[model samples]
Target: MNQQALSAFIWSVADLLRGDYKQADYGKVILPFTVLRRIDCVLAPTKQAVLAEFEAKLAAGVNPDPFLFRKAGQTFYNTSKLDMRTLIGDPDNIAANLYAYIQGFSEDVRDIFERFEFATQIDRLAKAKLLYQVTEKFARVDLHPDKVSNMQMGQIFEELIRRFSELSNETAGEHFTPREVIRLMVNLLFVEDDDILSKPGVVRTIYDPTAGTGGMLSIADEYIIEHNDKARLVMNGQELNPESYAICKADMLIKGQDVSNITFGNTLSEDGHADAKFDYMLSNPPFGVEWKKVEKDIRAEHEQKGFNGRFGPGLPRVSDGSLLFLMHLISKMRPAADGGSRFAIVLNGSPLFTGGAGSGESEIRRYVLENDLLEAIIALPTDMFYNTAISTYVWVLSNRKPAHRKGKTQLIDGTLFWQKMRKSLGSKRKEIGDADIVTLTRLFGNFTEAQIATLFDANGKEVGRRMVHKGEFQPLPPEGGKIKLAPLSRIFPNDAFGYRTITVERPLRDEQGNIVVGTRGKAKGQPQADSALRDTENVPLSESVANYFAREVLPHAKDAWVDEEKTKVGYEIPFNRHFYVFQSPRPLEQIDSDLKQVTGRILQMIGELSA
Candidate 1:
């Protein structure tokens, strides 16, 4: 069946089950059924071949591994006594047959999911007859090997999870990272590096601490495969949520991914993979979640051997311990002893400049900044995710930066970037187009700062341009006078430069003893005439000389201003520096005579024209 028809059928099943369960809870039913159906479909074509091969080995008195019954290239395993065609061939005993089918799969595909947690939950399906109906409903539409590629199946799974996340809103932010956001993160982190793509058999491990659905890791894997045929990607992750953990494990199995290290349990409290490090790590941990209630052993382990020293600035605030996960990921960074690593994480704005002054969070920021490990921080637009519409940022950290980027951080204000997809879900939220993604990725790859611009004020005036320069203001002088220096600004509404203004207001007394005043004074504590302006009335004439003298005069003439008693005569170079204006070899007298003759000729020409 076409994708639309298939999706409509599956969504109907999920919709039916959703009435009895939470919106988020629908994934528990739909995801597993979808996985089983696909696996069964794939196995059906090869079922006879697999059984004959098993019988041949048995007849030869040679028993191969039972797990080989579901080999990588096989259509499906011959585990159940009744496959979809026979069980659904008669719908009465469908539930009982489906239960048997699942058991058969558990036994046949043991090695594939030997370490997964789904085995514990599969028994619960026996009580829910609706699940069998859903499975039978899924059976009607074939998701077989020839009908759907593994990637297409993955897409369907991702879309269902995304829809569930949208409908439920409970695990909306925690369970899924939007595909566009994941694409942007992957592009920005890898578009420039030839190291990951150019080398064949170069094993680069991709990891996520909270690998909800394993979308981020899988997408990155696909991206690498697209670029290089021989690129080897090893995906590893640690997930705390059981349903999502189970779904991720099932996905790897269907895709034929080696998920030896995809582990369950809280990554922060009891990391499932402590000794392993990765070359590329990407994640979107649950925002504003706390895990400080970790067991004392975990805390002691952290203090003794984990990231306590790295995050020693301060323990994160008790309410939201998001940074704890980031620190854990950083601790697992590929040591320089191994090949270097890079990481990209999506976070809210709080981490950028939160914690007030010198807070533990601030210390963390300071350490990261001073060490120059922060490569770039891209601020995504608002309402980009399915959950809360809070603004987010992508923090890109690299242990090995190119020489030019050392000791500096690139802050990409991508909040303004992105184009809305034609079929947008709602306001301030949209999918980024290919052009948008390309532009953003290129900007990130080139580390270009030219496109950076600032927002305007309430009046729409650009802040950077209109905000007065506070360096120093040069005060206007009286007619033909020298320029003067002004002090720094100390009040609002000061001139272009940050200066203080004082208004003077005085009353005029009338002859009748009534005050008819024209009020005036320096605008509140304005400076009296500056003492440096020795004589305010004696203004300098030459403009250039005035400018030069204002800048160069004071420091050079500090000790030269010898005051004898009250009236002092300065015996320094008082010659006007303006003489250089006429210092040419040709005299002005000859030039003026020539100008007079030319003026006479012009006057004669005007008289002739009048006549």
Candidate 2:
């Protein structure tokens, strides 16, 4: 069966779970059983041999892990004689047999079901007398790798998770990112290195700090293998949610990866791969989620291990820890001398300009821009996620940028490159089509400032669009029509995002309008600054501070002087402002005509009623 049918078949088991299980608890029983059935089918071919080897090793008094691994030809093996098919033979003792069958698997596989809390789910099903029916429903289907690839399985599971999350009123985005978004990120990530990645023996590592069901890792692997069959793509990740971690680990295990590399628990509190680094990384951390739970651990590292820890750049506010994940990924980047790393992260609009100068958010932005790690940040269309309708951005950073891109950052406005979905999924009402994805990828690869000229018919309906490159000929307006041009891509120097927040002080004066002079040490003859008259101004880093102060500030306040002691350097990306195009409103004649038409229609309706 295809992914949709398979997902539907698995979700069909929910019929037996309803009334016996709450809508929120349906996933608890269904997901574990689905995974169980898949693993059972995979181990079936070598089941007898593994059992024989286990018995032989036990008789000889030796560890059989190595022997069993070889016998099963898989990372995990089962020693129990009862498989999914056999459990149904004795429905009266189904619970006991199922539990035993689960315990028979290797510790790693068992741990997944354990985190899934399968034993409790089993008991709950047994008490409700729905265990047999649910088991039969999943067992009747096929989930073997030969039939369903890892990508298919991940998507299927994500669909089910989406349904369950909706029933529980939870955000599905917290569990998995949309596959199309991952594709665009992967394309942007691997585009510049196409020549390097196409080599036969090329090897690369991919990691995601927030591995939400391992979608990003799986997509990265698929992309590499598709381009070069001999290329090896190593996947690693960490997840905090137990259910999500279990699913991610299970997916990796079946794909023949080191399940141990995909870990569980809070990544901020515990560094699963502390001393490890990678070549490429991607993450979709929970949007606007707080990091208060791990504040103690993160703060400790930032304080004592300054510039020596993962959070050395700085910490974001406790209310939104999206930048913390970015910093964590930054730490995982391999040294530039050893061929540095490229990473991408999905973030909300807040990170672009949330805090003021010297605040944690601004400091993080400063570190990224001043260090020139930012390559590009593409703005995605709103309502593209399963949960949030707010505008989101994809930040691509690299320590080893090409010579031409050095000290410059690209910003592509992709909000217009989306098609409305046939049917909405939760908050998701739009998707970036394959053609649109191609257009976006080409725009990024070209690294040029471009605009999209949209042509409108006389009645104001969009007819077509043309891409306009910088310094190139502009498309002429169509006859009896109009054309609107909006920025599609923009490039800026790294310092363009930075500024100096200068505090302006004015002389203090007595009630009689006389200057008040200080009598102490260095201030003995200087006028004391007035606290009430103090104000601040932000000067662009591209312009000299003194020049900006003289041009814009001194004219308004003749007595104001720069207080260099209180000045701070900060960075922010006012992304939307660059793409905003001003359009003059329609002429008064047009408005008067429209108003007259509306009034005429209203009078005609009234006259018809009176007649």
Candidate 3:
């Protein structure tokens, strides 16, 4: 059956959950069962062979673990004599049989169900008189790889989880990211290393700190395989949510990956793969969420490790932990001498320009840009997430910058590159289409300044749109029509986003207009600063601070001097300000003419009314 039909069939099992299970509790029953059935079907093809191998090895007094894995041709296998079909035949002992079936699986697979709290669910279902019926319903569906490709199955899994999270009023976005967004990120992550990735037998590691059901890792793996079948990716991820972790582990198991690589815990508090560095990474950490729970641990690391740990760069405010994940990914990058690493992370607008100078957020941005780690920032369309309708950006950072990209950052305005979905899911009303993905990917790959020209006809309807690169001829509209040009892709030196926030202080003057000078310490012979007259000015990093002070500050305040001690370097990508296009207002004559015409029309209408 197709994915939609399969998903619908599986979701229909909720019918048995009605009354006994609240809408919120339906997922506890459906999610684990779906995973169980999928695993059962996957192992069904070689079940007998695996069982025979296990028994033969056991009789021969040899360890059967290796033989069993080989026979099953998968990372996991089951030694139980019963399958889903057999469990249905004995309804009177269905609970015991089901428990046995679950216990028969390998340790890794068993761990997945344990985290799902499957035993409790089984007991709950049995107590409600729905265990046998639910088991039979799930057993009837075919989730074999042949019937449903891994990609299709992943989609079905995400869809079901999304529905369950929505019904339960949980944050669905924390569990999964939209596939299109992941695709675009994967594309950008690999775009610069196409040659190396396409090589035969190229093996690389990809990680996600906030794995969220392993969607990002799965997509990146699929992308590499699709491009070069011989290429291999070792996927590693860590997740905090129990259910998401279980699902991610199951996915890794089915894909023949070492499920141990996918850890369960808070990444910030504990580093699952402490000494591990990866070739690439992708993450969509919980956006705008606070890190207060792990503040002590994170701060301890920042203070004690100081440039030696993941969060050594800085820690954002307790209110938003998005930057902490970025720092974590930065620490995971393989060093440039060792082939380096590239990663893409989805972040809300806050990270782009959140805190001011010396603040945690600003320090994080300063660290990334000053070190030339940022490659690009793509502004995605708003309302693209399932939980929130706020603007988001995909930040691409890399330590192994190609010669063409070094010391330069590209900003692609992709806010308009979306199509309205036929059906909205939660807060998500738009989707990045395949064509939109291609366009954005091309812009990043090209790494050039370009503008999007929208051609309008004489009547002002949009006729066509085209992307024009710098130094290229602009596309013009038809006769008597106008063309609107906006920056679609722009490139800037890394320092363009950097600025020096200088504290400008003015001397305190007495009522008689005499300057007040400090008599002791550091200010011994210097003029005392007036707190009321103190102000700060942000000067672009591209310009000399001294020159800027002379040109802009001196003219306004002759006595204002830069307080060097209080000066702090900061970086912020004001994405909108750089691409803002200003349009002049209509002339007074035009406005007067329009007003006169409106007045005449109103007079004519009033005259007609009198008649």
Candidate 4:
């Protein structure tokens, strides 16, 4: 069945939840039941064989796990004789039978249901006398692996969560990303490695610290498989939310993947894959979320472990921990002597230029740029997320930069690439369509300077667009139309985003107008800084501190001298500043004419009213 019809059919189960449960509470019943039914259908084909093997193994007093797995031909097995269809046989005691069936599954499968709190839903449904109906509604549908591929199942899962999110006015973005965005990121993550990834039987590993339904990992896996059927991508992820974690684990389990790779915990406080390294990683961590809860553990490591720990460079403000995840991903990068690694992460604008020089955020940016870890940063369209309408950016980094790309970072402006969605989902009113994704990928892959020309009619509505590579002739508009040519891609030196925030201080003077000199050891003969006149200025890393002081500061204060001890090197990606274009105001005659016309219209209205 198509996704819409399938989601609609699954949602029909909620019809039984009305009156007995709040609209927001519907997911608690629907999500778990849907997963249970899918699992039930998958285990049904070998149910009889698995149960017989279990009985025979028990009679012989041997471990049934291996035998049961062999009989089921899957990683997990349910040994109970009762299935969903069988549970429906006893409507009066269906709840008890359902519990037994769940308990009989292997530990991994059982853990999925446990994380979903399926037992509580069973008790609640049974208490409300809706247990049998809900079970029957779910059982009637067939979610066999043969009928529904893993991809379609994932879409159904997303649709269900989106519906629940819309009903409760919550953001599904917190649980998972919109797939188009994931596709674009995955494209960029693998764009530079076509040669290595296209080989048959090639094996690679992918990780996501903020797994969030494992959407990123699954998409990366899909990309690799589509790349080469023989190529394999091992997936690993960790999620903090119980429900998202359950959905993620269940999806992985059904795909014949090693579900143990997907873990559950706060990655910051507890490293789930402590010693694991990966060839590629992707994450859409909770943007602007606080790391205060794990501050103690993270701070201890930053101080104690230094460069040996994940947060070695520095820590961002506790209020927003987005940078922390970047550091963690960096730690997980395979050594350059090895195959090395590449990663993409979605972050809000804050990380680009929040903290000042010498601060944690600035230091993190400094470390990244100074070390040339950043590869490219793509600016996404605003309102593209389900939660907030704020602008977001995708940062792609790698330790093993191509020879030509060394010491350079590419920035692709994708803010204008989105198309309006036919239907809005929560805060998400726009989406990056396939065409947009291709354009973005091309811009990054080309890694050359380019501009996009937007044609607008006299009415000022956009009518056409085209990309012009550097040195190419710009596209022109039709008669009576105007064209806007803006830079679509730009490459910059790594140090372009680096600067030194120097503290400029003036000399202290006594009431008699004499400079006050310090009497202490270090400052004995030096002029005492006037605290009131102290200020700071960011000097570009390309310019020497003394030269900046001489050119910009000395003219205003002749006595000003550099405080070399207080100088601090910092970095920030002023993304918008690099692309800003100035527009001149209208001429005086034009302004006067427009005001006169408006005044004439007001006088005409007044005369008509009087008449």
Candidate 5:
């Protein structure tokens, strides 16, 4: 059966769980069992050989780990002769047999069940007199990789998790990101390194700090293998959610990756991969979530380690810790001398311009832009995630920028690139199509300014639309119609988003219009600035502060002077403002005519009523 059908079949087990298990608790039973069956089917072909190897090695008084792994052709093996089919044969002894089957697996696979707390679930099911039925239901489904590919199985897992999360009133997005989103991130992460990545036997490391179900890592691995069969991606990540961690580790195990690479813990407070650096990384951190829970640990690191730690640039306000993950990934980047690193993170619009000059958010932005590490930020369509419908942006950062990309950052307006989904899943009503993904990837790869133009006919119907590179001639508008243009892609120097906030002060004046002289030591006989008139102006980094104050502020306030001591460098990427397109409003005459037509019809109706 197909993935959707298989997922449906597995979800059917919930029918047996309804009265005994709360709707929210269905996943506690379903997810682990589904994983168990998948693993069971994977080892089925080699089960006999692995069991034989186990016996042969034990007889020789040698360790059987290597022999069993070789025999199973996987990182794990099951030693018990009781498969799910056989365990269900004896209805009364199913629970005891099921425990034995679970115990037969290697330590790694056994750990997965332990995290799932499968024993507790087993007892609960048996108490409800539902264990045998549930086990039998799962056993009937065929989840072999040959029948349902690994990619399909991954989708099935995510779908189940999404349903469970929704039922439990939890954010489904926390468990996994949409596949298309992961695909786009993977494409952006590897787009610029095609030459090196395409080389045969190319090996690289990919990590995700907020791994969820390892969607980002899995998709990246799939992307590399698709481009070059011999290319290999070693995946690693850390997750805070126990269930997600278990599922992610199981996924890696099934794909033959070392499950130990996926660690369980809060990435912010306890980094699982503290000693490792990766070549590529991707993450979609929880939006606007508070870091108050881990504030003590994070603040300690910032205060004690300073720049030697991940959060040294600056700490965002406790209300939103999305920037913390960005800083963490920044710290994990492989040095440019060691082939460097590229990463993409999904964030809300706040990080672009959340705090003012010298504030934590702005300082972080300043650090990134000043270092020329930000490569691009692509605005995604609203209603794209599973939980929240707010607009999001994907930031692509790299330390080893090419000559063409050095000192430059690209802003891609991809908000119009999504297609409506057939059915809404949570808050996700839109998805980026394969063609749109290609279009976006190409725009970033080209690294040039471009505009998307839409031509409309006389009836106001859209005739056509196409992307045109900067300096390229625009296509003529439809005859007797008009064309509208907006920036689809734009490139700017890193300094473009940076500015200096200069405090402007005006001298205090007395009632007689004389300068009010200060009586203090340093300010003796000098005019004191009026506190009420004090103002701040943001001077673009490209412009001299003195020149800007003279031309803009001084003209308006003749006695104004800049407070050099208060000058603070800040950065903000007003993404929408840069891509904004102005359109003149319709003429007053047109509005008047339309109103008159409606008024005349109303009068005729009144006259008919009078008659």
Candidate 6:
């Protein structure tokens, strides 16, 4: 089916659930049913062939994996009671029959849905009169294997997740990584390396701890397929959401992928990929999330072994556990000899400058930086995800680096590398176009650093190149730069951790001779404007405001002041005129005259009080 037709079909299914659920909640019912219908369609073509092969295998007294054994060599087979065709045929009995079928199917693929107790959820839907309608609508949608190719199916997964993210008003970081992002990461992880693609004998494993609907894993699979190479693409993932977990497992089943390895659990506390090291790791874990340390045994084990082992050094602060996820992925990196791992993690600014020195979070970053495992950090543009317009960063870490990138880290400022979507479309989710991906991928592949500034030390010396400002215009380079238009690369010295303060000045008055406070700038062809308070200097205005609040506001607050303090009525200063209105400093002689008048007034007041 074409994209528009397919989208319309999916939207129709959504329409059925319109009143019953929110747009975001509609996916809870539609996603699973879509997977079921697709699986049924796949089985329809291969059913007889698979069943015959399974019979032969059983006759030969060979018992294979029941889930795999039942299907034999084909992608799917109809187990007597619960196939999609059978369930949809009897629409009246669909709620009960479909529930039974789902239960039976889950049992067969038990390993994939470890903690996923879908029966209760399914039952709830059934009681609410939802299963039949949703299933019937999905049966009409063309998610069948033949109708939509595997690549198209993956696109559908992305579209659905994106739509859901949009409905919920989630942040860009909360939405799943776009295909372009995944493609860039795949390129970074395997830069034209034929060994990972063309060699089947080489056992290579890729993992995504926060895998949402298995997009990253499937993209890796598709990458291997497109290269026309044969490598064992063992994909493992852990997802915490039960609904997403069910749908992801169904996706794996439809593609006939090995589902035993893709785990369903909270990755931080109950890591599903425990003891298994991966060669390539890619994930866009939720940007800012808090995790309960309920699994004390796991926490204690990692703590005892030290942070470098699993956690590295110190645990992250309780509120933001983003670094902990990175630490876990870092620990899963194998040595170079045993298919060394490289990771591309999408993160927000929190991990980069969150905790200060001696904090557990800082120690983890320090460990990675000191060990030189960090390769590059790229800042992406805002509005890159479906829900939010906040900027995020991607950190590339490699356990095994090529000789050229040994001691250096590359930082690319890609915040300006996106094309804005039409305001009419107004899709909250913005995306990096193909051109941006090629540019980012090629720059990463080449490890360029020219635009990147080297970090400096407190003593006015350069340390090493670390990060690029996200403000660089990714415009076409000049003719002589020899830069590729698709991907630009430059080399710079490393930016040391050292930082220095630079000062800039603003005039005290406008051209009109009006005193002003705070910064002022002009719009093109428009008059210059200052801040709301009209303060000439931001520093003085801020200091005066702070002093006014502390001395005037806080001292008089009823909740904070005691009875004794309440009786003390200090002169309340007029905040607006006292704080924002700027006045010229008096000359020294004028200041002396003012002090003499103030002293005489104070003496008169004292004499009156004495009388």
Per-residue lDDT of model 6, residues 339-403, tens digit only:
57898898877787666445676567656755768787777877766655566878889878788
For 281-315, candidate 5 gives per-residue lDDT tens digits of: 99999988899999999999999999999999999
Model 2 C-alpha lDDT per residue in residues 226-292, reported as the tens digit of each score: 8888888889999988888888888888888989899888889898999899999999999898888
Runs with alpha carbons beyond 4 Å of true place in candidate 3: 592-611
The digit string of per-residue lDDT tens for model 4 on 1-611 reads: 87779889999888889999999989999998888888899888898888888998999999999898888878899978899899999998898899999998999989988898899999999999999999998889899988887888888888888778778876335777889999999999988897546778788889999997788888888888788778888889999988779999988987778999999999999999997899999999887888899999999999999999999989999999999999999999999999899999999999999998889999999889888899999999988887778899999999999988899999989998999999997788999999899989988888899988889998888998999999899877867889888888999999999898888889999999999998999999999999999999999999888888889999999998878789898889999987776667989999999999999999999999999
Model 1 segments more than 4 A misplaced: 1-5, 15-24, 58-63, 66-78, 106-132, 292-298, 306-313, 423-428, 452-611
Ranking by lDDT: 5, 3, 2, 4, 6, 1
Error of 3 at 302 (Å): 0.7
TM-score winner between 1 and 6, please give it: 6
Q: Candidate 5: misplaced stretches above 4 Å?
A: 510-513, 604-611
Model 3 steric clash pairs = none
In order of appearance, the predictions have TM-scores of 0.68, 0.97, 0.97, 0.97, 0.98, 0.69
What number of backbone clashes does candidate 6 have, counting pairs of residues 3 or more apart or in separate chains?
25
- Residues forming the 10-long window of minimal summed lDDT in candidate 5: 168-177
- Model 6's C-alpha root-mean-square deviation from the true structure amounts to 18.5
Clashing pairs counted in every model: 18, 0, 0, 0, 0, 25
Q: Any runs in candidate 6 off by more than 4 Å, and if so which?
A: 22-24, 49-72, 103-133, 168-172, 192-194, 197-201, 292-299, 423-429, 451-495, 498-611
RMSD of each: 18.9, 1.6, 1.8, 1.6, 1.4, 18.5
